[model samples]
Target: MKFFKTMFALSFITALFIVGCAVQQPVQPIPDFSPTTFNSNDYVSALDNFLIILDASSSMDDRYNGNKKFVTAREIVKHLSQTLPELGQNAGLRSFGHSPKVSDKLTVLFYGMEEYTQKGLNEKSGLVSRAGGTSPMHTALTAAREDLKTFSGKTAVVIISDGQEAMGLKLPITLEAAQALKNQMGEDLCFYPIFVGDDEKGMHLMEEIANIGKCGFVTKADKLMTGSGMGQFVQDVFLTKKPMVQAPAPTPIVATPPAVEKAWVVGEAYFDFDKSIIKPAGFEFLDKVVDVLKSRPALFVKIQGHTDSIGTRKYNDALSLRRAKAVKTYLINKGIDKNRLSCEGFAFSKPVASNKTAEGRAMNRRVELYPVTK
Candidate 1:
């Protein structure tokens, strides 16, 4: 009777409540994009190294879209790692403002400056599982300087965060640290800050930090969630196309050999910090240069040495000269006529990229080879 009706009503309400509670917004899926497979003959590595700075601050604990921002950030990094082609680039991951579950420290270089591998990066990124601490971004940036201290060549710093600081009190200090890293690394470094969440302030802050490197760009996590977007971002930051060299078409058999275009010109050679000794990669490249010179006895080469904006002009001038001489000596040993090889040092002047970033500085610290036909 009435009691039975009451029980029925209560049961119906309970069932409705349970149903309502069970219904949840479906998690957004990570979209697919064509995966890039890098071919050494067709493409070259753009960045020699990269470091990812992830924000595990409390603000990232807040929900964004359908999930916690921290979860989204973690997935983004993992996806980015997968999307990145194995380019022999050095990679590292640093997480800041994470809870005890993630790490006891305020910041941790959880991954590497070691050779990049998708599985390694994804596993390390997953370990940063919780977010519950004050944002100490400045400390992370300052630490990044140490993380990349020994790495040479072009580097990219990827910051994935909601861009919120602890009460915004340390924002300026964080910016200063980023600037210091840029100044320390010079043209050899760039920043790619990926903003998570929809906070307008966070987006702006990320943009400013990216601007500090002068060469990087700011992106949103939503955009990067898609496969195509991630592919483009990874390619833009990590790769450059190899110059296309067209071979001559076959002709009728002739007694005389056909003249060939000068397709074997060497571009530039890089040096290690403060050292004129050729690096292993430099030796391989210079061996190619030796072949080109041997093929063209009528050609003379002008080797111009340059240095980054690190030391005094006088010291750099001497260093640059030494680097030039090192290259000249290599050519002579390979049996190229020393009389046909001329070299000069430009010190820290005539920069190809801004001396304010590590990658730029690396570019400046090089020897340009110009081949002239006698």
Candidate 2:
């Protein structure tokens, strides 16, 4: 018995020596961030309230492209933190599959649902040192109900994940949780999922999750690999793109009198009663507007959305804005430059006709296009 014990001890000592000889590389320090070199402020955030849910499960430690997935994701998150346009949004950072187990209380809020800043996010992101535990993304989604319960206006939930939930993970619960969040937030909520690697199944699952929210879409993680790439992603997901305004096109027909001319207005476009839906005739006219815009490339146009006064001022304003956006979307679809088009919802505030009668109200519900001087 003593001889056998001695042999076993010798074997253990040899194994320990071998393990100690193996070198573990130190984690590389993240590159220093330059705000001026990477800032994107030309546009503003689209969301009034937003949250970033990062995946930190063990799977993230796996390799992707060349580096570890977790490191790549963390870098992307850091870049986004630095790149997000400040639009007075209440933003928070949450992580699931990070705790020892999946639990309601395990969903950790590192930053806040408070006013967002790049510095604050960078600090919060530093708290996540490594990836461990199983992914409980559903629990994280479910937790959003409480996190965004009080905030109002357009909300965005940006989810970054490799998209692979743990085996036997509660995926159905995730779908259900997403639906519940939608029901609670209504049209105010949007989901933008970012995939870290080429996992088709994981990507599809994320796509389905985004579809449940009914807004935003699935995007690849590598899109934020560089400063310019990161800037573009921030602009796409967060910033509200500004219209590309240029100097007004010079009139070829020089009149003898140098008098100011009124801006061109497309009066043929009309919206239905109490609705923002544009008519087929309106679509056709907008196509002509597109042709003119294409022809006069130097000019920017403003889309004025108006509504009948049948509804409250607040309701009318929103409806008119939707109508304006609808018109802008049509013009964009017809190959018109988005940067050259701007929209302003006037609601019942700007009425060309009387709102006391049906005929006048019908005329009031219309969108007008006006040329903008540079």
Candidate 3:
């Protein structure tokens, strides 16, 4: 009788363990925000011709967040190139760093979007040689404007640098030059100055330029590069209608099918704060998900979005959904069937880590994608 009791007790404990493993709290769904929609064929005055003027001055070699300014700028350009197709945009490249004299002429690394698409651009072969000097912001802008004159479509000039103008040209003068170009090119021409590193002077100058050019100003490099805010900004600038650009069309939302047996695949996708897009490093893990999907043809996955308990729940929820859908869209673009994937947002309700510290919050704000057997 004692042996029977022992066996029964063991079985009870085993059953509890199995039940514990099986029971999972339902993850709160993230709120979905309406995204902007635009007609693909409409001539909405898009800046199809993007001229990137990189400040390759010696000062750009300074380190920010453990990476050199020039290096970070390069990576940002590469990211834009890879992601531009999603927005139906294209870009060209030029730099002032190759000049031997501080006043030397700016070098055109890549002429236009067509060249960028056909030949491809690389740091070693395409970037201006590291013959560093002062930043000739005015010269670079003027040269870019001149190069863009022949092109008929809308044009945008983006300057990426630490804001130190090599030619000793005043910020006001540079602003005037950009404005003059805008006036010449008509209101369709936009100027965007992206200051690398946390230089107050450069940021201020960029703000002034954006104002004068009547364009958008992006200050926080990390945030501007990664997150939903950035995605929205891209949509506004390229896709939206009205005086303000509209958001991109929201991804389709599907109800969870009762017949499907779901299995959670959770992992953290890190991003710079106040941003909703994935970084280049995050893409490697996404590649793994692609591999898994390729191997398991019978399984379908649902992506759950989460965020650190920061901002209001409403905002977090919306941001989380955007991030999750962004991942799903990326996967689909890589050839995954759209029908096999579903995404939902959980916001800050599912906190895997404390939001008290930056590192913890980084871990908490992530997109979890797992397989479900239907």
Per lDDT, the best of the predicted structures is: 1
Worst 10-residue lDDT window for candidate 3 reads 249-258
Error of 3 at 178 (Å): 1.0
Model 3 spans > 4 angstroms off: 1-45, 86-90, 99-105, 113-125, 129-131, 225-230, 240-374
1-374: candidate 1 lDDT, tens digit per residue: 99999999999999998897787555665455455455645554577688999999899988788788898898889788777767577899999998888678989999997998888998998889899889988889999999999886678999999988888385688899999999999987899999998888888889999999999999889877877788778778877654353222222122222233332222334665566877555566677677777888998888888887654454577789988888899989989999999989988878877877666666667776777787
In candidate 2, which residue pairs get closer than 3 Å at backbone N, Cα or C atoms, i.e. clash? 244-339
Against the true structure, candidate 2 has what lDDT? 0.74
TM per candidate: 0.63, 0.57, 0.47
Per-residue lDDT for 1-374 in model 2, tens only? Answer: 99999999999999998887664344565555543243333443466788888898878887777677788888877888777756567889888766354333457888898998878998898787677787878888888888999887778898889889889876677788888988999987888888988888788889988998887888788767777777776666666543234222222222111111344344555665555777664555566667767777886888888876643344466788898898889888888879988989987778887866666776777777776657
- Candidate 2, residue 212: lDDT: 87
Question: Which model, 1 or 2, shows the larger TM-score?
Answer: 1
lDDT by residue for model 3 (1-374), tens: 99999999999999998898676433333223233333433323244566778777778866676666776676556555443433334556778765464335555444454433523544432446454666667776777667777664456677777776655567787787777778777765777777778878878877777787676565455644563544555455544222223222222123222222544333434644446787665565677677767777887888888876644344466789988898898899888999999989987788777777665776766777777767
| Higher-lDDT candidate of 2 and 3 | 2
Measured by TM-score, how close is model 1 to the native structure? Answer: 0.63
